[model samples]
Target chain A: MKIGIIGGTGDIGKGLSLRISDKHEIILGSREAAKACEAADATVCTLRDRNCTGLCHGASNEEAVRDADIVVISLPFQHVAPTLAGINPTYLENKIVISPVNPMGKKDGYFFFDRPEEGSAALAIQKMLPASAKLVTAFNNIAAHKWTLLDEELDYTVAVCGDDAEAKKVVMQLVSEVSRLQAVDAGPLAVAGIVESITPLVLNIAKFNGLKDVGVHFG
Target chain B: MKIGIIGGTGDIGKGLSLRISDKHEIILGSREAAKACEAADATVCTLRDRNCTGLCHGASNEEAVRDADIVVISLPFQHVAPTLAGINPTYLENKIVISPVNPMGKKDGYFFFDRPEEGSAALAIQKMLPASAKLVTAFNNIAAHKWTLLDEELDYTVAVCGDDAEAKKVVMQLVSEVSRLQAVDAGPLAVAGIVESITPLVLNIAKFNGLKDVGVHFG
Candidate 1:
């Protein structure tokens, strides 16, 4: 499968490219095409250094969206609307779009779920896309830093949620393809907020417990 | 410590008595004093069947609250207000109260977090208690039936939440004593909704994924 990641030069984007590039084509995108190219090259170099093979490339955000079978929105909550708007809505129509974006804010040295008026980031993103776009919520709770560590299995559960059953199945299959990552269907898009909200809860858990890179497992 | 469970005839109440009675004195309470006593005796019998000794006793709801150093409100959301109100408020004053109650409702064959107008069951519960009673949220997301299987370790993380730091610490200590249960501070009482919300999310996961006795672990 061809997986395109918007704002893919970030930690999660680079991590995903390195983790799944061997199985799926990874297109890392950025506003600055040159920076995206640099990040993509680094992924290849990092994988190659470990005697691993990966198929990855860089593209402008528009090109990435236009060319992929599935698209991942890996940007911060505030950047999601403007970034997706910059790309033509036609590029995203009828595609399986994955949202790992979590709306979170830190106050008084603690994190809280910055729930949007639309209920969740996925619901908000759904409105921005063409009517046919199948929006799925996934990869929202894994620690971003854990993604690029190939030596360590993800060893976490990914709760996948979407209105379209087919799209959710495809995303869940993709999740299982990653190392030691189990996928569970957490029901439709309406419940996405509960899964997304776990990100902030884990953040707080990590801070107060003096733990690092906290991740979730639903057993 | 002496721990009193308000709804001591329920599954959670019986499970807790069987699990923690060895470490702490377990007081099982119900509206019917005789039934609570019968349940407590049953807990002792169940533990003894496995050659495990547990200290458990039964009492009326009022006696349970009046006698214990710590209290566990193991009732459903709807029953909480009346149950707590029937017990003298003075008996609950300054006691550390644990709430495992999740306000959940099923709709169209799926369960959802029936979020109260007070935002969460915990917040609504907090309003019902006396001013000095320290309300802490724990064990909200664990699989209920898993608690009784002593042969199988309850390997899950419990997210403990509360406003009172001392009470939270006490509760966290007790959680660690459970079979392979790790406790993490998930910040103040305000964030209890997120912790409470995972119950419904896990319920959905279990139903949609064809699984049984689903539990959570924040690793």
Candidate 2:
């Protein structure tokens, strides 16, 4: 399947591209096509180091999602609504949209975030996007560093949720293909609030202490 | 100095008592005196098993503070104000009172917490205590399991705050003597909100993922 990663110049966008580039055609997309080109070139260089081969191209966000079956929005939580609002709703119809954004605020060496009443970021995105777009929440709890280093078999669980069961199943299949990681079906999109809030906690643990490459595991 | 732990039957109380009993006159105090005695006896047995000569005794909260030079409150954040309110202000005056509590709320297999507008649980206690009473905030960010294990020499930092500089200095001294741990001067009582909020993050990391036994280590 052709996967389009919007905001592809970012750590998350590049990291996700690196993880799945071998099995799928990955396109790195950004507001500026030149920035996306730079990111894709950098990822290609890194992947070449491992003797892996696949296609990872860069283009404008609109151009990237035009021909893709699955679109991953790897932008920060604050950027999601505005970024999606700019895109034509007709083009987004019938495509699987994945959101991994989280809300976080820091002040005076302490950090906290305000969670939406609906309980998760994925649900929030589901509410914002066109009804034709299927929304799935995943990767909010995983560290960006660990996601980039796909070679390591870490004991981590990614909690995935969406209102559409089929959409979650497709994302889960994609997550399983990433590595030895398991994606848990946590329930509907409303549960995304809890999943989104968990990221702040992980970030706090690493910030205050010497914890590195942290990952969440669930039964 | 004769030191007392207000919530002496709980994990933090027993851990602190075990760490400090060797060098100080340690006593356990709680609302239920008999329960305090049982906890002290168990702590002694655990100390003996570890081949330590540390001794701990038990008493009522009222009697515990009546003569002690230092008193530590390890109750949950919700109970901190009332716990100190129940103590005699006259006894607390001119004596050091330490509090270490964090507020945490759980939902959907994930843990998150609400920040009290007053800031942290420690600041709340400081405000609730009599003005003449010396109140210090410490131990809100340390992992209870690492603290309970007396011989593990790991480099970890504890954020400490108080309105009184002298009282904070004394509490820092006690913290150093008890666990031989590094205590970072976080700031005045106002920053207690920031320090206390770190708990939910740590709890979320510990509860949600593969990062167990993870404690904060500030550089």
Predicted structure with the largest lDDT when compared to the true one = 1
RMSD of each: 1.4, 5.7
lDDT of 1 by residue, B146-171 (tens): 88777788888999999999999999
In the range A60-156, model 2's lDDT, one tens digit per residue, is 8887788688998988778888888877777788899888888766766655555554545676777877888988888777777676776676456
Q: Which stretches of candidate 2 lie over 4 Å from their true place?
A: A63-70, A90-98, A104-126, A130-219, B1-3, B23-25, B63-71, B90-100, B105-123, B130-219
Instruction: Write one digit per residue (lDDT tens) for candidate 1, span A1-219.
Output: 999999999877888898999999999999998999999999999999999989999999999999999999999999999998899999998999999989999988788889899888989999999999999999999998888877888989999999899999999999998888899999989889999999999999999999998999998
Each candidate structure's TM-score, on Cα atoms with residue i matched to residue i, is 0.97, 0.69
Q: What tens-digit string does per-residue lDDT give for candidate 2 at B130-205?
A: 7888878788777777767767753556677776889888888887776557776665675565556556555654
When just chain B is superposed on the true chain B, each candidate scores a TM-score of: 0.98, 0.92
Per-candidate clash tally: 0, 7
**Fraction of the true interface contacts (Cα pairs closer than 8 Å across chains) found in each model:** 0.90, 0.00
Model 1 stretches with alpha carbons more than 4 Å out? none
Docking quality of model 2: it rates as incorrect
Cα lDDT of candidate 1 equals 0.92
